[model samples]
Target: MAAFSPELTVIYATIRTLDDQHPQATAVLVGGGRVLAVGSREEMAALAPRAHVLDHRDLILTPGLAEAHIHLVAYGFSLAELNLHGARSVSEVQARVAQRTMNTPPGTWLRGGGFLLSELGLDEYPAAAVLDEVSPHHPVLLFSRDLHLGWANSLALRLAGIRPDTPDPVGGRIVRPLGTLLESASELVTRVMPVPSEADFLAAAKAGVEDLAGRGYVSAHTMAFEEPEAPRALQTLAARGDLPLRIWACLPHERLEQARELGLACSPGSLFQWGGVKFFADGALGSRTAWLHGPGFAGGSGTGMPLDSPDLIRERGAEALRLGLTPVTHAIGDRANTEVLEVYEALRPLADEKGIRLRIEHAQHLRPEDIPRFRGLTASVQPIHLQADGPMIRELLPHRVDTSYAFRSLKAAGAVLAFGSDAPVAPPEYRANFAAALTRRDDEGQPIAPAEALTEEEILWAHTRGPALAAGWEDEGIIRPGARAAFTLWDRIGGNARALVL
Candidate 1:
C-alpha cells in the first residue's frame, strides 16, 4: 500500500531556519501542517511540482514567534477595560475613571489597571478619597501595572466590607486611609465583583488568540494568574478550531492536588496543554512587595512581603515534576530569587530524573553568585519590563543593579532564556523587547547593566526557540522538515512582521 501524499504548499522566502544543519533556505515545502522539506526554491519546486506556490522572496522567514508569558483571557478582557497605562498623576487617573463612570450606570463596578506608583509620581499609597471625588456613585477598582496592588474608591471599599481597621488577610495587607489593598487583600474587593459568564470567557479567549496571531505570534504561554475559566475558554477555542495560536498553560499551585486527583498531566501535541505549575515567591518591584535582602527599599519600605512559602513550592513542585510538569516559580527581588534557587537546588535531582526543567519567572533581580546556579534551568523573563522597572530598580534596589534583567549572564550560565511580554502588565510588543534587550535602556533613557544587553539574534532565539523548549514543544520554534508549518514573515528581523498563514 502506498502512503497518500497530503496536499502541499511551497513557501518561497529568505528563510532563517535556526537549524544548525540547514541554517538557511530559499523555500519550504509544507504538507498536513508540517514542514515537508527545506531547500532552494528550485529544489523545492522540483520536488513538489504540483504544490501551490506562495512567493515571498523579499521577506525574511523564521520560526513563528511565541509570547512566553501572559494571562491570555485576562489580556483579552483588558482590551475593553479602562486602561491606565500612561496615567501620569492621580488627577489623570481620576479623570479617566470619571469619564468611564459617566458612561457606565451608577453602582456599576468599574475596573481597570496599568498604573505604576512611580510613574504616577506618588510618594505615598494613593488615598481612596481622591477617587471618591470623581466616582462616588460607582465602585472603582484599579490595579497597579504589576497587579500586586489594588486602589479602590470608598464605595468599592464599602462594597468589599473593607474599613480602616479591617485587619489584613493572611497573606495580604490593607494600607491606611481605607483605599489600597495589597496582595491577597485585593481579592476581598474582587471577590464581590460580578464574575464573567461562559460566553464572556469564550469571547475573551478568542480575542486574545486573534490579537496575538495578528501580531505574528504563533504560540503563547498563558500564566496561571487568571481564573480557572480562562484556560477552559482557551480549551473551548482549541476544540472548536477557533484558536489561532497554540497555548501552553500553567495551573496555579493551589490546584495541584485537584489536578492530580483529576488525572491531569502534561499532555502535549494539541493547540492547548497543561505544561507548568506556577508558584509565586513574592510580588512585583513596582508594588513594593518584592521580598528583598536586608535594608530594603530606599524609603524604609521594609524587606518586602513574601508569598507561597518555600516549603510549599518544594513539596508541590516535586508533585508537579512527578507528573512531568515543569515547576515555574515567579521570583523578582534578590531575596525571592535566592529562596527559589535554594528550593530549586533541592528539587534539581528529581527534576533531572524526570527530564523536566525548573523554571524561574521574572528572574529580575539576582545576586552575582546565583547567576551560575540557573544552569540548565529556564529563565522565563520579560525584557519589556525593563522599560518601566529600570528607574525603580535604581531607586528601590540600587545594590542589585548589576544583575537586573541579566539576559547575557543567565545565558552564559547555561539557562535557556525565554522572553515574553507579561501582557496586560505590559503590551506583548516584541519590538520593545528587542530595543530594551539590545540597548539596555529604561524609560528614563538610563543604561541598566549595558553589558547584559543581548544581540538581535539572541533576542529572536529567546522569543522563538527558547519558549518552545520551555513548553517541551520539540517540533515548534524552528523551520525544518518535520517541524510545525508556522513561520513569521518579517520586513526586517525585529521590525514589521506578520504570521505567514498558508
Candidate 2:
C-alpha cells in the first residue's frame, strides 16, 4: 500500500458494503486510504478508540460511483462552448449561435453541440445557410448530439476547403449542400481549428475531473474521443497528485503501435492508467449511421456506415491483449454489434489467456441471438441515452425496438453492465441514468423497452461495481476491508448523492 494519512477515521452510517461476507455495516474504520474494518459502530469504536469519527447515521453509504465512459477533456471544454441540447427547431439553433457570435470577434470560430436532427424537426440534412444567416462573419461548427454528425456553416466549410464536389473520406460522408460532415469527415474542420495550448488542455482535464468528483464519482473511464494531449494533461494531474478521481483511459486504436513502441502496458496502481484501446465499429443512431442489418432503417435511410473493419479489430485486438490492454469497441447498431461480436469471438481465447475483459460500448441495439454472445464481456452502456433515443428507435428501428437499451436482458445474459453518461454527448448525471434505467421512459414519456428496465440496486451496481470490474480495478466499487476508502453518501437509493471526502 502507498503512504497515506496515518490518522484513523471511522465513519458511522448505514453502510451497504455490497460484499456477501459482510453485506451491511454501521461503521467503517479507514486508514492509508483503504478500509481497515467494517462492523457496528460500537465494535469499530472499540477497535479504534482514537480514530476521528464522522457521524452520518441517517444517510446510506455505498461504494463510490464510477462514470463508465466519458470524453473528459472535451466535456470540460464544452462547459464554455455554446449548448443546443434542447433546441427544438432550426430557428432555436440559429438564435443560440447568433447569441454566441454577437459576444465574440468576427473571425473567431464558434463551436458547440447537443442537437438531434430528429428533434430539430428536419427531414433532411440541414444546410449551412441556416447557421450562415446567424453568424455569416464567424465560422461555426456544431455537432449532432451523438457526435457522429457535424453541422458546419459556409464559413467553416470554406475554411476546411470542403466544396460541393469534395469526395467523402473513407468511413465518413459529406452531405450535399456542404453543411454536414459525418464520421471521419468532421475531422476536416476540427483539424484546421486552432489547437489549445498545454495549459488549456490541463485546465480542461482538471475541470472534467473536478466536475465528476463533485457529482459523487470516485472514478471514470475516459473514452478516447479527444486529442492525445487530453490524456497527457490527465497524466500530469496524476503526477502532481491533483486528480481526485481515479481514471482508466483508452487510446484510439491508431495509437496502438506507438503505445507498443513506448513499452506502455496496463500499468495500474496510480490514480491514472492506460487500460484499453478504443475503436468504432459504426456511427450512431441519431445520425442515421448505425450499421444495421438488411432492411436497415425503415425509411430507406439505408444500413449505417461501418468505421473500422473486423479484420483490423481482430488483428489489432490480439496485439492489444498481448500488451495487457482490453479491446473496447463502440457498437450501436445490431449489425455493428453482430460484427464486433464475431471479432471478439476470435479474440476471446487470446483475451482469456491474458485475463482481460473485452468491452463493447453502447451495445444499444441487438438481435436476440446475439444477446447470449455478450456473456463474460463488459457491456459499457449509457441508459441516460435511452431518454432521448427512445422515440428515434421507434421511428427508425421499430424492428429492433424490443432489444434496444436492453439493460435487464444484458444483465440476465451474464454481461457485466457498466452504466455511464458519455458526457459532452450528454451531461454526466447519474440521476438521469438512474431514472432512465428504472423507468425505461424517453423524453416523450413513452416506454422504449419496458421489459429492459432495471431495479435501483442493479443500477447502483452498474454505476459502481460494474465499471470497476470493466477497468480491472478489483479494490474499488465495493466497500469492504482492504478496499479503497472512497464512497458515496446518499439520502436514499436513486436519490441525491455526494462523495464522502475522506
Candidate 3:
C-alpha cells in the first residue's frame, strides 16, 4: 500500500519552482510528502477538486536548504559551554572562565571552547597560571573555535599529565612552558576526560538538530567525530518518526572498513544516508596549523603543519572510491588545498571510474593558479567564516586576499560551490551565510573581496543545488514536479521561513 496526501491541498501564488523548464511556475500539488505535480493554479485545482489550498500570496518558495559541513555533536555541546570566540585579551578569557567556575562545582572540570588566538591579543600562547588564578580548584580546558588548538590552565595541564618536558605527540604540538596544545596534542587532555553518557549524546543531538531547523536548514551533512552512540541516537529519532530534518552522515576514516562491511556506500539513500568518508588533511587557520605555501604568512615563524601525508590521502581516497564513498577531506591553507588537489588529481580517474565526486571541505585560501584545477570538484565552503577571517586574512596573507574565498573565480572555473556554516566552528546560521555571501563584508565593515560577492540567486543555488550535486542527491534540492516536496517558504531571501512539511 502507498500513502496519499489529504485530498485536495494545492499551494498557490507566485511559486518559484527552481525548475529550468518552468522556472516561475505558480502552483504545486502535494501528496504523500512529495511534490506530486506542479502547474498553473487552475490546472492543479481541476485535477483535485476538493483539495485543501494554501495561498502564499507574499512568499518565495524554494527547495529546502542543506548544510554541506558541520560537526553536529560538538555544536550541541557548545550550546552549554562558555564561549570565547571574541575574547579580546587573556584577561577577558579569564573573566569568562572565572564566571563559569563560580557557578560550577568546586572540583568539576570546566569544559568549553571557542577562543581565537588573534582575538586574545597575545603574541605568544598565554601561560596556564593566568587561568589557574580563577579556576584553581577546577580543571579548565578551553578549545579554540576551530577545534585545532586548546588553551588550558595549570590544573588542567597537570591533570592531563602534560609538563614542560612532555615531548610533542606525533602530528601535534604541546606549546611550551605549559599552556597550549595544538592539533593532535589536544587529544591527550580530551581523552583523559570523562566521556558523555548516552543520555548526553541524545540530548546534544536533539538540540543540534533543533538549532539547525530554527536556522532554516532542512538538512545537514554531519561530519562524524562524536561517539558511536551519536549516530544511533539520530537513527532512533528517525525511526520513531521524530526527525524534523534529514541528515547525511560521514563516518571518520577509521571506521571505513566497518562501514563497508555493513554495506554502506556513498549516496546510499534511506531518507538519511551515509554520504562520505571524512578525513582531516591539515589543522585550522586560527591555530596557525593550516598548511601554507612557501611564502607562508608574512611574519609568522612557521609555514603551518602538514597533517595527513599526501600519500596517505591518495591511498585512502582510492580505497573510499572503490567502496563507493565520496572522499571528503578538510583542507584550509593554500598549501593544504594544493596538496589535496594533487591527491584528488591522482584519484580523479578512479573517482570518475567509480562514479564518485571528490569533495574538499573549506577550500578557504587558494593559490590563484590552482583555482582552475578545482573545476568539476565540490568546494564545500563556509561563507560565515569570512566575517571572522577577513581581518586575519589582511594581516596573515594580505597579498592573496583578493583570491581568498575566490567564489567568483572558482565558479567561473566550473567548480561547484557548496556553501555551509562549518557549525560549532561558527554558529550554524544560514542567514549569516547569506548575508556574508552577498555582502562580502567583515565584522569591521571591510570588504574582503568585493568582486567575489555573489547575488542572492547564486548564493541560493550554492546552498541548494551545489550541495545536492556534491552529495549526489538526485531527487533533492530542486522544486521540479518530480522532486521531493521538501521546501521552505520565505517572504524574502535571508529571513526565517516556515518549512512546510509536505
Q: What is the C-alpha RMSD of each candidate to the true structure, in Å?
A: 1.5, 2.0, 2.2
Tens digit per residue, CA lDDT, model 3, 1-502: 2333356468885666656887777788887667888878877777776778898967878888888888887788789988887788888988999999888888788888777777777667777888988889998888888888888888888888998999999989998778889998988888887789888888888888888777677888888866677788787777777778888888888788787788777555465777788878888878888899978876955788998789988988888898888889999999999999999999999999987789999988988899999988999999999988888889888877998888988899999999888878888888888889899998789999899999888888888778888888777788876677778788787787767657
Compared with the true structure, model 2 gives a TM-score of 0.98
**Model 1 residue 475 distance off true place after TM-score fit, in angstroms:** 0.6
Clashes of each: 0, 0, 5
> What's model 1's lDDT at 27?
94
Evaluation by lDDT, superior candidate among 2 and 3: 2
| Model 3 ranges with Cα > 4 A deviation | 1-8
Residue 368 of model 1: what lDDT? Answer: 97
Instruction: Give the alpha-carbon lDDT of every model.
Output: 0.93, 0.94, 0.83
Clashing pairs in 3: 8-51, 8-52, 9-51, 9-52, 33-502
- Candidate topping lDDT: 2
